[model samples]
Target: MKEGNAISDAHQVTAWPPIRNLVSDMLAISQRTHNGYGLLEFDVTTPLARIAEHKTRMPDGISFTAFLAYCLGHAIGEHPGVHACRQGGRLVVFDDVDISTLLEKTKPDGARVPVIYIVRAANRKSLAEINEEIRRAVRDDLYDDPAVRRRRRIVRMPALLRRGVWWWIRRDPVRRKRQWGTAVLSNVGSAIDARPSWGLVQSFLPCSVTVGGIFERVCWRNERAEPRKMMSVTVAVDHDIVDGVPGGRFVARFAELVEAAAGLDEEFGTSAGDRAEGQSR
Candidate 1:
């Protein structure tokens, strides 16, 4: 079959579901179960301060990205419901953790496009591997490489032309299988700045849970009035999957894990002992 014809058939098989219906159903079930919607924020000043103090010599050099992904996976493993998706008015929870990292590819003319892929059985990947995959996906060279461009061109037509194709392709019964996962991670850390005023949730995706990592800021203690580095994390979740209490609990547990990992002397190969020796100067 021709490529266009194949895409058309796939879209027909994989019809996108309505967001409001799914959200409402989830909310109703959660309410019946006494679950509530929730949002939680954390202040990482102290942990960051501790990391910076030992950075000179102990540079295990783990990037913040790696740490964030590990924390996300750990949290999902602890809170299973946080990784659920709505399927035919029912909640389908995934057993594995597959965090989708969003990437923006810059074309020759400067237009940036987003592409997503599931990192199969992601919980099995180590911190270094996760970090490397993310780096490779975002690299301009990877996006612009001749071979890469050729492959994309052959497989993906312009969105305008592909719409009808996608519609038909999605209609296939088998193609409609749920793309559920434990959670979704959006690393906006590169755009580090003040907390964003707003963000839009993608309407047709299987992401019931989403987390955004914003710019790191300097946090200060109240009484001591000391300055410390910190990063802000924003989580937007489907009200249907989890209620406020459980949501808050999940965030708290996730934060604790991040804090502990951040404080590790051997994280990213940097040792506290090595840093202490250098600080002696």
Candidate 2:
């Protein structure tokens, strides 16, 4: 009731970190781009099963994010136009599918932050390689690099100077791809306790994907309702480069690959008995 009573609520002010500032800058820039958003669901039962099976051999285990990266790379390889960036009057499409993913790390002060790691030539790498790379990035301090350090310095600069750096990067497709990668794939699902249906992500990259947690649902199959694992995936593409048709085709192909569990067997060496058993099933 009194002013003094309202002050009883507890709060503390912490200075915003450089990483947070950088993310804010990226969002501010991405807002200017024409972005098309799509919220879609995929059946991930097959991939989960396969990942569990493969974990018997892989002690560290494979992650669902790695599987998604595998599927996304292949999808982009099939539809490269979806990740093209406009350069003057022409569009620049890179042959390699470099995917930038965020890895959360805790600082010495115990503050958690997300760091970007690019999986170079993701389209050409096997699922196991991708899984190992992600695991290695988490296990070691590789996520902290000179480039990120440079970014930390950039974020500390004045807002106008920081924005100038981003503008310079955005103007050239080659520099942008080399620095930030051709696409972004972030998985926020694994970190949270409760499953989220969907989440929107902003990025300066041409294509960005946000992978959400899985929820069980019933789907009509063989004239009967069957329980299935479903995940919400949000995709945003730069309309300046990616058109509606190509973007739709890319999304459809990505869904098909994910539903089919396209690359599970390629992750590791499977015994003949295991293959035969899988075939029988």
| Candidate RMSDs in order | 12.6, 5.0
What Cα-based lDDT does every candidate model obtain? 0.52, 0.83
At residue 198, candidate 1 shows an lDDT of: 27
Q: Across residues 151-211, which tens digit of lDDT does each residue of candidate 1 receive?
A: 3553445445444443343344223222323456666656645553223344232333333
Candidate 2 deviation (Cα RMSD): 5.0
TM-score of each: 0.58, 0.89
